[model samples]
Target: MDIVPLLDRIGEPQAAALFGLITGLIFGIAAQRSSFCLRASVVEFAHGRLGSRMAVWLLAFSTAVVWTQMAELSGMMRAEDARMMAVPGSISGAVVGGLLFGAGMVMARGCSGRLLVLAATGNMRSVVSGLVFAVVAQMALQGWLAPVRNWIAGLWITPGGTNFNLLTSLHLPQQSGFVIGLAFALAALWLARKNRVSLRVLFTASGVGFAVAAGWVLTYSLSQVAFDPVQVESATFTGPSANTLMFFLTSSPVLEFDIGLVPGVFLGAFLSAAWGRELKLQGFEGAGSMSRALIGAAFMGMGGMLAGGCAIGAGVTGGSIFVGTAWLALFCMWIGGMATSWLLDQRGAVAQPGLHVPH
Candidate 1:
């Protein structure tokens, strides 16, 4: 029958966290196996090569879009109840925040999700960067930097913001939206047809897509629990990272789904790295490198808060749901990342080409 009611009748919050953990584990394992870094994908695409990584990202996005829509149409979920609903769409915020986040990912060498995975695999640089990311994200979301974020947001909020997708704007039936989303997914996969994709990429992409969809479904289900309040969301890292950090530092006994998801990713990645023999102890070069990482992470934290999502949160998860803010942020992040990548190349300071375990 309806598992949502069943789950609510049993253990509510813990069950939600368990679902998030499962999703996070799948996402982590896939990311580790495929080396699915968005920055890396951007760099590969910039080189005029159709990268499977990018394709995987698109696949994940399209899959989530279709699944989420289907769920909504089936009366399983309502996207309007998501956390992003209250946040007014700010194109300026999306563009500037995305640009900053993209540039930061270049310097940090991974988005928030990737950093979580890397940190679990003994990458000290990622550990440091993750900490900075969490702390700064916390600040921007609800701490001292909140005023700055509010001020920026107050400057350029869009009026009459539509639901983050074309389906809603088209005023079409949900089935019509599903068809369109399915077509978009197929098109994205077809465009990546030329790329020499591997089984790992396919598996990783599917896992990521499922994880995103699962987040929506799980959170939506939890929202129906009469006693406990849960927001409808999916696998986003920015606010989750901050929330996770806050959980440990505060006296709250309740654990949200994201807290479990974040740690589960780390655990899965750690195990995957150990299995793959990719795990290694590594750190930044010196004070200069550390300084750069801190600054970059700071940018990501602030940008992620303003844009309302990070790479995975906005790019993949939000994109899956076809949120306009996410789409715009993803575009700006790409531009900002590409510009930074090009600049670093010109300065002869770009990291060595090809992915590898931290040294």
Candidate 2:
């Protein structure tokens, strides 16, 4: 309740920005090294390959759940402290948003995080996707689509209407949710290892999960301190997608950009690319590819808004907390991606020349 002491201890804006930078750096590194992308994973899965991408995603989910639980049990944090848990009706939006985001991500070839990391690595197509995502996200958030979003939000329905985290709705305790999440993470690691994937791949995938969990812990926990009482700590693509666009446009606003997990993710990938010598300025080679990236970015923005998060936001961070909406959003996203892929395949859209795998 009392944040003055906490603020005095950490030094608000500076601490928050620093926290973001560190988290973003780690996320970028993991993403660059592992090529951790939800779009790629879903696409590959649909294409009949049991690749390590999905495993990496699951690992992140499990790690988040376990770490969050540990934090709560140790009195290091509180679940009620997060914004997602405080808004249950948003579950409806999460599902719809996820479905849209999933489809868009598939069309665009990556999610928000992937786009940022890829853009940092000099992938031109990713740069375009990132730009489109940021722009459209802003439009959806406060520009053209705000009214529609608000209207749709007003239509949400649930019995009792109580704010329900996934665990609460399922009649599961916080401890149980943590256990389940950790168990799943361990299982994912085991399965991934059993596949005889290269140690580099294995480490990269697992490390991404750890980085994600650490991001939530650092940001949300830090935000809770008195110095900077952030209402929530989350990792999703939509808000940043919009913020990135705003930052680019209003560069002279002297905008106090809070360095958070997403920025760290971008920095992480930049550093990783630098280390690997993989950084290069690459751009869309085909009109069709550019179109796809634009359309996909729009979809990701709208869908993320509806779903309440993207791969990291809902799929890993929120999902780990067992938010009811996160589960719905995750499945909807998968379905949306699969649906989009199928539609594209039927139209022979995916077979276009220059449409190479990003990872």
Candidate 3:
């Protein structure tokens, strides 16, 4: 009984697709249950309520950082293999793109990953945003926006002219970087809990964070078993989102479903939602709201393309590794988000303007 042959028969692409579907479902269900939203987290923080979502994001970052570094140290992966750490990296592009992405997320009310989860949970606005995000991301990746992004990327200056993580660039070792980064994360968690931390908030945040970290560990590590030549990497959402959309379109050419992290997130979310009886279909109320979602999606696509990652990619995964570009992107994303939120507030776009009619 050669089970290895049977497993191999299933193939990689199919595994990836199945992974994506499962990932989407898990992401949808968890997000729906905990109200896990990146935009909402930032908004709440901005408004002085930061005990729940922010903690979860921080915990996820901390867990990913520790796990990724351990993977590197254990010969399972290499930091240099990540796209954000590549030579000739686009520093300017990351900042500019992050700003745009941040702004767009605010306008659209969620990041691309968040939008997918929301869509699965019957948020029609999110579905519109996800569709728009996919279309514009594809366009930006291979259409009119490509040249512009390239031009901006060309302006980056690596003064030291070396390929190194931020810690190394500052004359620190990998171990020191790990320790310092972990310390910072712990400090943030401490501060978040310093003033009236609730156990519910802590549990939800920690659980979600662990789930996200587990997601990366499982998919990347498992995939590497089949593709032994490649290094395993984890905890990215943007490029995968765009790639999944393309895969959906070009399914005829590639017919294998490989279980990847994003797909796992979807599956996990979906199952979680189904178990809780929360799955439903919903649509946008009107053209105006739909238009806003579309615009937000386009911005997210363009910005994520330029920046080379999204909230999860740059903000948590790479950022935790102390990747300089990731930090730049994260800062710009925060700024862009804050700016967009302010603009939206100015326009009084807080509440749904009309009645909620079922679709």
Candidate 4:
């Protein structure tokens, strides 16, 4: 959709926020209904099964990859200009941050995006954890933790500096993205069918992916037509969560994409849950669970900032575009998640004993 006329009317910031709201709403509903979560997928993998949860994650991820590549091929978006690519990335940060974020996901029983979705569905445990996640994320971004994040991030740089691309590093053709995305889609389909994931689940999971792709394309499209420059980006909760928190705290807050995105996701998730009669007030099973979740949220807040994105942010959003550091981060996340699952899940209620995973 050409947004030039709309840009003239509502201005760039407002337009971006509007788009973010729409993108987030789609993502929230799809994720809420489909239970698209990387943490559960990793746990399933650790348990030696590609079950329904794993299938949902795979479907959402592959669908994002496929659609993103298609958009690039159609000239609707240019992934090369996205911050994940344009800005120099850190190898060390990806490794360390991914490990922390993954382990925290296990402890928290959800990743940042999943936590927000659960919170919207009236999970009090998630609400507390989510708020903590936001505060820590803000700290990591600009507070005392910023120096630490910066130091770690400076430890290792991407091989080719700012213009790095995984596919390019591998000497692959431009069309290879489409080919690779198609392959991912096929594998995801195989997993879905094997796991007997319902059609409804499959469809909603695909919606999540589509929203991610739309975020990239729509934002890029806006940047092309707008009088002022805008960042081309896609869905990610870490920074957005922090920004949203500050938006409410400050008297004269700036209008931006992240500001609208968080509330939009919450509203969308809440609406879907309420409509489906799935909204229920839930709290921590015990003090152990609450403390564990809060600690996990703290880890995720710092780790996500250091790593450059959260699970959905780096794994699905950036990975779809074949960003070098993003893929590395995603790979490390899986390794960390699998390791944590093996250690915690194998203990049979060892990780937060009475803590119940929200459905």
Best by TM-score: 4
Query: Against the hidden true structure, what lDDT does model 4 obtain?
Result: 0.89
**If candidate 3 were superposed on the true structure by all CA atoms, what would the RMSD be?**
5.4
Q: How far is candidate 2 from the true structure (C-alpha RMSD, Å)?
A: 3.8
Tens-place lDDT per residue, model 4, 134-205, is 999999999989999999999998765683788888999989987887787788888889988889999999
lDDT of each: 0.80, 0.72, 0.65, 0.89
List the lowest-lDDT window of 10 residues for candidate 2.
251-260
Q: Write the per-residue lDDT of candidate 1 for residues 17-98, one digit (tens) a residue.
A: 7878987898888778767778887776666666676777667667777877788788877777776754467777788899
Better of 3 and 4 by TM-score: 4
Best by lDDT: 4
lDDT of 2: 0.72
Q: Write the per-residue lDDT of candidate 3 for residues 167-208, one digit (tens) a residue.
A: 777897778755764775686478557645465544444444
lDDT measured at residue 29 in model 2 versus the true structure, 0 to 100: 85
Question: How many clashing residue pairs, candidate 1?
Answer: 3
Which residue pairs collide in model 4, if any? none
The TM-scores of all predictions, comma-separated, are 0.88, 0.88, 0.80, 0.95
Off by over 4 Å in 4: 346-359
What order do you get sorting by lDDT, best first? 4, 1, 2, 3
